[model samples]
Target chain A: MNARAIDVRGLNKSFGDRHVVRDVSIAVDTGRITGFLGPNGSGKTTTLRLLCGLLTPDSGEGTVLGMDFRARGDAIKRQTGYMTQKFSLYEDMTLEENLAFVARVHGLDNRRERVEDTLHRLGLFDRRQQLAGALSGGWKQRLALAAATLHQPRLLLLDEPTAGVDPKARREFWDEIHTLAAEGLTVLVSTHYMDEAERCHDIGYILYGRLIARGTADAIIRDSGLVTFLGEGPGIDRAAHLLARADGVLSASAFGAAVHVSGLKREALEAALVPWRKEPFRWSEVPPSLEDVFIQLMGRERDERYTS
Target chain B: MTGSLPRILAVLLKEFTQLRRDRITYAMILVMPVMQLLIFGYAINMDPRHLPAAVLSHDTSTVADSVVAALERTGYVDVRYLPRSDEELDQLIRRGQVMLGITIPPDFTRRLLKGERPQILAEADASDPQAAAGALAAVSVLPTEALRHERLGLGAPRSTAPAFEVVVHRRYNPESRSPFHIVPGLLGIILSMTLVMMTAMAVTRERERGTMETLLSTPATPAEIMVGKLTPYVVVGLVQTVVVLGMARVLFSVPMARTPAGWLALACGIVLFIVGNLSLGYLISTLARSQLQAMQMSMFYMLPSIFLSGFAFPFLGLPPWARVLGEIIPVTHFLRIVRGALLKDQVLADMGNDLLALGLFVLAVAGAALGRSRTTLD
Candidate 1:
């Protein structure tokens, strides 16, 4: 069997009286992409930091690339490349200069050749002389990706790498990530976009510092056991509000000109939609989507953790 | 550690390249001290000559002429105008036209002939009371001229003799060459100011740019990083010391009686002390959130050092409480050591206490900085 690229268990962290991460565990296979999906401040970034040795957990036992996470942090750091959410490059320097600085910092041999190759691979060779600050968001994202991969680390830990990137740019970024994964680079990326999460081999959904669900996109949707019905009409906003207050309705949210109503009990969801069926609104029972399952999961979890 | 050598060298090279790009910093590093030396070297004058004075001769006789000649002979005073009226003399003193105004009464020649003692009126500007005191002593010498003629029996009656005598002794800086006093202290201020400001800002800039974290994650330990950052500034400090000392010799003619090697060694020690102070500043920068706050804190420390370090003012003349406060500053001890070695040709034995104080300060500050850098948080 191939060794796991990341294997960690029973991770916990607390800041003052608040537990930021609680008993979280996850594993990603070698050369596979795993998505960490959550809302803001949902322990996703903290977990990523813990995995990459950027932060030490209060109580945890984990091995990253066969090295102990706590004791061999330096070794782990040397073998992993972390790209932070913010644009953390020297803004005054040109694109080529920024990349060359990272290369030299890593003490990589053939630095000039490596920098040329990385820039060319990112399709940024034409704009190599442009100052980093002057580049558009898309080009800046490309530069960050190139700098992250210049050292060729085995594992890549990315924290919300596509937060402010446009849809087209984000799609291109995901394509490049997949290409890197195909070359046997293990990637663990956290993202808020559902489409980005769907592209992952497996997904972990965290809420309020707790892992609520984990599986493939299809399995997470299937195993959630939620029955969702869509109501299409001109006045769906009132219907969504009324259905949200209705009995047995797990979650109701608007999704692009349609209101998707979901409940764990199929009969109850159908009964809740029965009142809206007499008007111009049309209700159709459909298979639950990943968004529906996640919304229902989020509805079931508390907004904050309670300690007894 | 061996594998990280190339990486450390790369970081050093990158820092140097970035420093080169910052032309303002380059100019500050190279030009500021020389300009300060040239300007301040001329501005500070301890030995002042050619003070303006007014002479009032109530008797226009040879004795009064002799008195005027005596005052002119001293070369310390320049008799600007002989006022015809005493009110004019008072006006000259009030307007600051003359710092000293002397009056010879009409009975001055008759008093000398009758053997009655006559007092000469000498009024002076007492704003800078010390300046007036020096002028007063100089004016008293004029009466000695009259006595000298009487003793020689050439131009004065033999019956007239001076009843009392006055003697003057100048203290502290006898020759009053400003450079002798200023250059030694300027060396301390220049080294501390440049080293602390530059190193503090440089370290803070790295942290601000997120490069410090990159360096931390490397195989280089905190100690290695600190040493690498400090080494270049030490070299710069040594070069500045040499330039300042050379300028003092060429322009101000300040002499150094000790061997060149001894001076160099002392300067190296001072530079080390400065580097240690700058390292402490870097530790402060790490705690600060912005460049402005770092600069403010540096200035806060620098202002007191300039005032209390005995560089601009005499440490001994300060009040007891001020002196006690001044002793806490490293620059205070550094100024004392530099001036003692350069001016007095003081050997290490004579400066054992100052050397010990500087050594302890360096170790304490360097250790604190290293300790602070070891922890990730402020």
Candidate 2:
């Protein structure tokens, strides 16, 4: 079997004068979970939509699930499941009815039996009679998951599926995602949460409609060429705030009693931290964190924007 | 008393902001009454005149000529067609091409000279009796007044009833029952109002609920989804139709399916009407981004259909320009089909042109709806 579930190149989309997704090329291996990490309006959702058949690109070409994505969008849509940012299931319908509606829409065989099995598997059998709108945020997220995955799509795309969900529910949702990935479903989920990105096998960071970073978490942090210095002292909070505004500093924020300052250049970072180094404040060089790398990338992108 | 000025000003400002935000509602509030006034004032004529009348005269005598001439002078009848035979005149009236048809007997002048009253026939297209009422009532005095000078002194009776009497025959509705005109027309208006509004709201509600993205992402084609969305409403329309028709039959005493052919035509017309309106509403939904806009558009369509489609007034009462506008609306043609089939026992062959017009409307809307059901979110 082919390893790549989604392999697209040079995909672009624009609505009116606003160019949303530009030159987005991505390839997801089979059975792997790829997390798209970006801030809101960073082309994560639009790029995800382009990967699935929900949106046609202004100019793009590739195969999705081994079929020509544009020429065979209907065929692609049949095998793929896309969960939108909002809870989009029929609110007036019960859990079972929503699942049944999904089944009926896709023309799945043994619709009733499939719906029943899905309900039972999700532990939603008891409350299947409850309307989707009445469900709490966590339950609504879970129901959206069930509805998206009901057809056993080979590829899944979820755009910020767990935004407002609780921590416990998010863990369960990730666990479900991993289980589905293990079963050979290529899943690409978009979210801003650092933990969610860490949970994925690989991550892609998008900024200004372009994929800026793509790798495992450790690789992304290492490739960012970011350096950090962890300072521990009584007056470090005041020192950290001063350090953040100093030259060559990417970001510096208090993490507790201690403060961490990050920068792209080691010399500039050391020089910036030199002021508070002697007076009851001890500073040690540390490996840059994932959050530090993202901060560095955002600052660099802003610089690139002004320079261009 | 000091704070009241500020409070009232605050409310006025808030109202202006809301009114600006909801432009469609603003337009509806301001535009509806002005349009109603214009339609009622200028377009609507309670007593329709210059009605198209066909004259089928078998008499070649001067008396028949004067009678036909007199009917024209009343200003209610415009003698547009002179048919060769009585059957041709009946055909003209039956097709609703003319409001009335005058048929003079072959021995009309000879019988009147022999002091015998000859019955002159005037057939009225009574589907909309109000249009032909004045013309028929005035036909009784037409002959005596028309022959007043040419009476040959004592030869003719000119004081009261004419020697050659006009025997008015109301073809479709003999007693000119107003219910027959009104009850059948209600079907089209009710179906258009409900079916169009409901379907428009259904699609807009889906978008509002954010379910449209999920629906479009599925394998279900827009055509299939459209069918799924509109299928349930078909049943609703049918039930409503049944309720309205049943009540019309019981309460208003409107006749139901006078012929087997009428039953078939009515059933077919009703089905087409419901689907056509549903498709139109769906088209509106595709254009409307919000539920409020969809509702406003439906009201925009419904109000015009009620006023301008000749449901409230006579179809021929409006000017030629207005009739041209009415021809475009689906309700106008559907009303014709309903009244033509139910009251006049007109078969499909009789209203083929109307059925074709309505069928074309159905196809156009359905095609446009399907086309507007975009697979891509763009």
Candidate 3:
């Protein structure tokens, strides 16, 4: 297998007059988990679909799984698995039936054995006869995971797979994803949660169909060049609201009872905090967090929009 | 609970906005009833006209010619065919190109001039017994009715009893039972019901329940997905066919096919009709964006089929426009093919045109469906 399981270049898609995904390109190294983080409708889903050959790009072309993805879509589809943003297994069908159907659609041999193995591995065997609709949100996600992966796809694309799942179930799902990646399956997952982004081996942050930042979590935070000040005082929430409009302050928000103010100019941020530098309010410069960096990125985009 | 009225109203208003977003389905729901009312009200006629008939005249007498003319004057029957022999007449009625057949005996004029009773044979295809009843009754009185005319020089000289006799023959259903007609028609309706409704929901249900994205992501070709979706329905259609055919036979004692060829034709027709209907439903599934829309469209197709395919009314009685609409629907042709093969014991050659038409219906619908089923999410 090639080192890059997913290698695609310059992809574009539009629905009618509105362009949804434009001049986009992405590649995933084999056995790596790439987290996609963006606000909703940033074309994360659209790009994933384009990469998987589900939606045709208007102008770009590349290869997926070493095959010409656009021309040999069926071949690429045979080796790739996609889990949708919503739980998409048939609600009327039982869990066992859903897996078996996927297997049959993929034309896999020993379908019964494969279904049994999938159910047993996922610990969903007891609920094999239960309808997918009857399962809870977490269980439904797990079932969808099982159904998508039954064909032993070389690449897996998950769109917000843990959105409604509980923390415990979410951790377990992540653990399973990691386990599969370790077994040489390349995975690209989209999520909005900070903790989930931290768990990914690499991260890509998109804004308005444009990929603005991409690196490991640490690399992105360091490359952001953002300086944050921690303010814990009696009225930090009020201070945060005031600081948000101050010059050189990129973003200001109350994190729990503390106020987090981040900016590119550390001296200017300190100068702006002169009025609140008092006995009750203690301000200390700290390293920027992933969340703080993301906020700064969004603020930078807003700033550019205002200036333009 | 009473205090929640405003909140309930808020949700209701939001729901209305959502409903409006589904513009096609909402518009269709409003349009369906009015279209059905107009088509059924103005177009369906229980009393059919221009019932096609054929003539075989072995007698070259004026009496025989006048008798044939009298049958047409009844306004119920139109002589569309001049058969060379009994064989050709049988072929015409069996194929349902003509519903009524008149066979004048060679010795009818000779016997009538000698003051001896002679029979003028009139054959009516009784598969749809009611369709032929009005015309058959009129043909049975043709000899006396023709003789009563003073314009006929030779026939007027003889008394009413002196004229030749007319004998009526009811083919297909010897007793003219209603079930014989109804049972065969039910086959067409039942096939349309199960095949169209079931296949219509197949893909739309996937989309509504959010499974379409996952389904499309897989390596399965659109053709594979469609065939997999339709295979189970084909089996269901077969079981339905057997059940309906068995019940029709046991309950109504509908006549069985006289030859293996007729049975083969019936089998081919049922399979074609079922497959054709499934393809049509698949086309609808691709067109509709929601399961509700699919159901509405299915009903939109079915109502016209039931009304215009001669299920509840005589097909010949319908106006030309309604008949043209009926011709496009697969059920109408399947109805004729099934009834002809089972009731009239028509072979493939007899119902060839109908079978060919059904094939065309399948190809058109299936081709459109495949074209629409591109893997893109457009």
Candidate 4:
């Protein structure tokens, strides 16, 4: 078997005049969970859709599940599961009915047993008779996940699976994702949350229809070349706005009582922090976080857009 | 292919569940056909009676008075106006006050007594030909009846053959009942409007509800999706057929196919016509982006089908181009099959062209619908 569940190159997709996914290439290994982080309309969802057979690329050449994806879309679709950003299951159907539908669509032999097992495993058995539309936001997503994975697909693609979900529910959802990945199911998920990015085995940050930074969370932060400083004082949080507009400051923001300022050059960052470095204020060089690196990356892309 | 049946069943069950949950679709399915049947069956009349007419008689003789009296006994014309001149009668007819006019000349009684064969001119407003046909036919038989009555008093021999006699045999509908003509055609029309609109909204509803993306992401093929989604609706269409046909039989007393073979032919035609309409609606769903757009598109299709497909008008009466256009609509061929099998007792063997046309329509429209259906979001 191939080590990668998905191996694709030069995947291009466009809607009318807007080129949404531009020359994107990605490779995801089996049994690993990969997270995609990007701003809205950055092609993260489009790239996820293209990997599965949910969308046809304008121009692409790749093999998904050891077969040519474009030529053998039906074959690829059978092995792939996609959960849309929205609650895509039939809102009018009961939870049990939705899972049964997915199971039957995949032609599972033990449809009832599988639906029962999934409902119980997801802790949704108690409310299986309720209409899916009546479920809370977190439960709706959990049901969506249950339906997507009901067929035991080799690869699972989730688009913003927890947008409006609470922190506890999101954590539980990630725990379930990790448990599935440990059993050798490949997952590619997209989200706007930084904590979710930290939970992934690998991360890809997209900007303006292009995948710009890709690595483990720690490695991406290290490779971003962003130097960050922590400043703490009585009113140091107010200096975030002033330092954000400085020459070398890429991003400056207040985190409760302390303010974090990041830049590419250490001297430039230190020089920008000079005003708040007086009397009671204490300054220390700290490691750049994933969010700080992503913010810097977005600022860099914005500068590139203006200059070019 | 092995998984096709299961996938189709999955879609069929899902559609059924949603339909059961939707109260609006249930109301539409039951109420729309019966309401339209009542409105069209009871309210509209193609053959009218007791039409208003104007009579102007210049001769005040007994012969002229008896002729005028003979016109009213036909039950078609009601002589309500006694205009003084031709211009007054013309004004009454032109302004839509009266439908017919009768004028007696000055020398009518003298000419009739001398065997001059004087003419009593009868004029009709022929703008609505259906309304005028019965009234004018009544006037034509008047001369013979009145002359036969006059011969008894004049003492003339009744052995000689009078003028020409017209013997018309109106087959199937001797009484010219409007319901007999309209009810069978209503079957075609009701199926076209409801089946097309229902199926057209099927796929678009998924798209609008954002479930289409998830559906496309599954292992289901386009063929599987189409077959699965359409099967439940096919049952619905069949039930509607039974409803409309039952109402036609019980309420309107419309005749049905006589022999077993003829009934089979009707059944086959009905199935083909339902599938054809469902396929056309699926094709519209592929073209439309929303349920509203699907409804609008179904309406756009229904207008031409109702007008050009011999449902509301006579098929042969249309212009050549319109007749050619009517031949393309599935309702046209289906109407022919229905009217033939029910009223004329035509079997499958007798209606080869119409059945073949309906069969070809199903194949062509189903092929187009499947071709246009997308397996992917693109």
Question: Taking the candidates one at a time, how many backbone clashes does each contain?
Answer: 0, 0, 1, 0
TM-score of chain A of each: 0.95, 0.97, 0.97, 0.98
What are the per-model C-alpha RMSD values against the true structure? 15.1, 2.1, 2.5, 13.5
- lDDT string for model 3 (A114-189, tens) is 9999999888999999999899999998998998789999999999999989999999999999999999999999
Q: Which candidate is the best by TM-score?
A: 2
**Ranking of candidates on DockQ, top first:** 2, 3, 4, 1
Measured with C-alpha atoms, the lDDT of residue B323 in candidate 1 is 61
lDDT of 3 by residue, B170-287 (tens): 8988898999899889989988987898899888888888788888887667898899889999999999989998999899898777799989999889889999999999999998
- Which candidate, 1 or 3, would have the higher lDDT against the true structure? 3
CA shift of A36, model 3, Å: 0.9
- B82 Cα displacement, candidate 3 (Å): 1.5
In model 4, the runs with Cα more than 4 Å from the true position are B1-162
Q: Show pairs that collide, candidate 3.
A: B48-B317
How far in Å is the alpha carbon of B71 misplaced in model 4? 24
After TM-score superposition, the amount by which residue B300's alpha carbon in candidate 4 deviates from its true location, in angstroms, is: 2.2
- Pairs that collide, model 1: none
Per-candidate DockQ values are: 0.13, 0.85, 0.76, 0.62
Q: Lowest-scoring 10 consecutive residues by lDDT in candidate 4 chain A?
A: A268-277
Tell me which of candidates 1 and 4 scores higher on DockQ. 4
- Give the Cα lDDT of each candidate: 0.75, 0.85, 0.86, 0.83
Which regions of candidate 1 deviate over 4 angstroms?
A303-308, B1-174, B202-220, B235-243, B256-258, B319-324, B347-352, B374-378
Q: Could you give candidate 4's per-residue lDDT for residues B1-378 as a string of tens digits?
A: 987999999999999998797664565567657745743454334555567777788877766567667778887777889899988876666444566787788887666665656677777654334555666776777767655676557765554443223233234565667788788888899999989999999899999999999899887888999999999988998899899889989998988889999899899999999999999999989888768768867876886688777678655444556668779999988887887788767678666888899889889989999998888787
Give the lDDT of residue A36 in candidate 3.
94
Interface RMSD of 3: 1.1
Residue A203, candidate 1: C-alpha displacement in angstroms: 1.1
